[model samples]
Structure formats: C-alpha cells, structure tokens
Target: MTMHLALSALLAIVLAWAGLLNLAAPAFVRAEFEKWGYPPALRVLVGLMELCAAVLLLWPNGQRLGALIGGLVLLGVVASLLRTREWLRLEYPLVLLAAVALVALV
Candidate 1:
C-alpha cells in the first residue's frame, strides 16, 4: 500500500507537470503539435484531460478511474508517436504506460 501510494503521488506529479506544460503551449509544444498536424487547440484539451486524470489519481476512491483516464491519454500519445514515426520518443510514454499499469494493479 505504501509503495502504491508513493507511485501514485509520483505519477500524479509528473502528469500535473505535463498538464501544465500542455496548457502553457510554449513554442516548442506548439511547434511539435504543428509538426504532428494537430490543431493548436488540441493541446489545451489534452492538458485539461491530463489535469483531470491527475486529480482523480490522487483521490483515494478515484485511482481506478484515474488509471483508466491516464492509460487512454498515454495510449493516444503512443499512437501519435507511431503515426509521426517519432520512434525515439516512444520510450517515455511506454514507461509511463507501465507506471500506470502498476498503479492500477498495486
């Protein structure tokens, strides 16, 4: 249980940080989205979902829902990376997927 809580906190922090970045939509993020052929507004939408997932993850009764949401978000990321042929960038999301799975199970 302690380990589960610790991992949950860590994952929530990472998700929150990423959510903020997506919401901020800095130049690099904008450029990346543009390169991927995504509309500028998509970043804000993704950020909002991420923030929602992070909040759920932190709620004792919401972890399962959080994991489900987080998994979907990460899967979208993985699919995007695959679509863009950004092979090298796949590792991060894959790792996050594993973490999400662990959090869900443990």
Candidate 2:
C-alpha cells in the first residue's frame, strides 16, 4: 500500500508538471504539438484533463479512474509519437502508461 501510494504521488506530480507546461504554451510544447500536427488549442484541453486525473490519484476510490485517465492520455501520446516516428520520445509515455497500469492493477 505504501509503495502504491508513492508511485501514485510520483505519477501525479509528473502529470501535473507536464499538464502545466501544456497549459502555459511553452515553446517546446507548442513546437512539439505543431510538429505532431495537433492543434495548439487542444493542448489546453489535454492539460486540463491531465490535471483532473492527477487530482483523482489522491484518493483510494479514485485511483483506478485516475489510472484509466492517465493511461488513455499516455496512449494518445504514444500513438502520436509513433505516428511521427519519434521512437526516442516513446519512452516517457510508455513508462508512464506502465506506471498507471501498475497503480490500476495494485
């Protein structure tokens, strides 16, 4: 249980940081999104969804839902990176998705 909580906290923090970057319209995020052919406006929506998922991770009852949301978000990210042949960038989302699955299963 302690390990589960720790992983959840870590995932939440990472998601929050990434979400904030998306919301802030950082140059790198904008450039990456543009390169991936995603609309700039979609960044804000994804960011908000990620923030919600992070919040959901704080409670036992919400953990599964949080993991589900996080997994879906990472799935999209992985798909996008794959589509662009950005194999190197695939590590982050794949790792995050695995973490989310761990939390969901445990």
Give me the candidate number with maximum lDDT. Answer: 2
Once all C-alphas are superposed, what RMSD does model 2 give against the true structure? 1.0
Model 1, 44-66: lDDT tens digits are 88898888889989998988788
For model 2, how does the per-residue alpha-carbon lDDT over 6-28 read when each residue is reduced to its tens digit? 99999999888878988998798
Worst 10 residues of 1 by lDDT: 64-73
The most accurate candidate by TM-score is 2
Shift of residue 12 alpha carbon in model 1, Å: 0.3
In model 2, which regions exceed 4 Å deviation?
none
TM-score of each candidate structure, all chains considered together: 0.94, 0.95
Off by over 4 Å in 1: none
All candidates: CA RMSD (Å): 1.1, 1.0
- Angstrom error at residue 15, model 1: 0.5
**Distance from true location, Cα of 96 in model 2, Å:** 0.9
